[model samples]
Target: MDLDLAQVRAFVLAAEESHFGRAAEALSISQQALSKRIARLEAGLGTALFRRTGHGVEPTGAGDRFLEPARRALAAADRAVAAALDERRPPRVDVWGHLYAPMRTLAQVAAGSGAPPLELGHGRDLPSVAAALLRGDIDAAFGRVHPPLPAGLTHRLVRLEPVDAVLSADHPLADEPALRPGQLRDSVLWTPAALHRLDFLHRFAERFGIRHHAEGTNLGLDGFLADVAADPRRFSLMPADVPLPDDPGIRSVPLVEPTPLYAWSLLWCGGNPRVDALLGALAAEAGRSRWLEYDPAEDWLPEPAGEPA
Candidate 1:
């Protein structure tokens, strides 16, 4: 049966007021119109919803049963209208990343602006995070640089970092002030997905042709270090400034030959609310920091040049 909000309101008001004139007045409709609406509602429901009385109207059993459902329907309609109104403009987007220095910088940049609140997604690496972005699950990702970016995505490199090879402190190479790929040839490797820097590993492999055996396909932070501790010959290459436990048995050495570097970047699909606001915030911070877009050959600093003194 068909019934409108107006009919439901008429039913409610008429039931509450008991007097046709007062109910019609409260509903801003003529008494005749109110009565007709109630009659139409009763006919549609095929139930006598109210009993007329000398004092006021009272709901019949059916009317009492329908009251809560009607109220719920009305409330749901109200929420739908509000949500639609809020979505009248562009759709809000979600931004995601690991809480690292560069990402923290991006967050600060985005947060500093008084724009729509940036919704942040938590993840450890770029690919999984970027996968979500590409699947339309997220609007933007701020983590390790995304490569071979899918169509319809734009990636902008905000910063670049030289890398260091992490090894057990007791290892012989760790004692060397600084070493290169050749020196690490026989070392077993323990790279984590969260490390998210593929190019560096490839470059190291290309230069020295080191097997760099992986202890486990995917290992957590503690597991990774534990595996390395178990075998002192294992080493992992990671970003230069990222903090690691100061374990006496672990060491991080600067790799020299295929000295690797990775870009810090922001990636997004066009025209999403989250993407626009986040990109704007990132751009603003980039401006204030005088941060230049990364250009591998030209922008990358030599081994120690850009590293902290």
Candidate 2:
């Protein structure tokens, strides 16, 4: 019996996510379709692969045994496809957290004469970027890498950017030279999306005892900054290097006495030569720009999965 790669892929994603709904979303397929593919995969193997739990599904003994091999098989297939494609085609690189403008760093890297040609794209977040990487839709992605990264992906931390608190010029604290996280405790923490989705911001607020939280629709960075500028009680954190809008009403004050640092990492599946070239370029640029500097005693960063690269 032969296995359909599509069915195998669906089974792999389901196993990784534990929840069929989330797996389906990652694969950009309907839950029913994912279920059908998984069922067919199980039938072809003549064994049950998953057992349902109250929360979702868990791989059975057979599935746990098959997991590593399935991953290797997919990697092999991706490599074969890459070999047949036009070698001159630039590697596709995607970015998340567009509000922070990850492209600024990418552009800096690409400006070097030794950098490889790259095709750029945008992803909604880490999950979507992971899905695209596993599918071989993109060669690499740049973003904040959190724990339990998707099964086949690897990452290298590239930069640690200082964060600043942006507020309306008229706010009570706007005149301060610099503010500590504690100073903002009584103010509302405004965000571009819900608190749950913005992990870094959520943790920042929690760590600082900033009790009040508010969210606004993401209407581009300018609009988001405008919203923060419009409310005296609202304040938001932004990467210090990100250029603010020209509006005079916005005041971007540095967060000192433990400046919050946003971590940027490069993620990839590991077989592409172009990925290696890009990584080299990024490493060189990062070193020259002092992009990886961090001092835990004087800076704030969320608990990371691994040491910075």
Using TM-score, give the best candidate's number.
2
Query: Best lDDT goes to which candidate?
Result: 2
TM-score per model over all chains: 0.55, 0.82
Off by over 4 Å in 1: 1-116, 122-131, 145-147, 193-200, 217-219, 284-309
List per-prediction Cα lDDT, in the order shown.
Answer: 0.62, 0.87
Model 1 global lDDT (CA atoms, 0 to 1): 0.62
* 107: Cα error in model 2, Å: 1.1
**Tens-digit lDDT track of model 1 for 1-309:** 655978887876666566778989987879899989988988999999888777767889998887655644544454455466775443233334322345445455655754446556566555566545543555566655534554455666655566787888767787887777678888876665423354556555555657666636454456666667667788877677777776777887886644566555667654444455555666666666655434444333322222110
What does the lDDT come to for candidate 2?
A: 0.87
- Residue 229, model 1, lDDT: 68
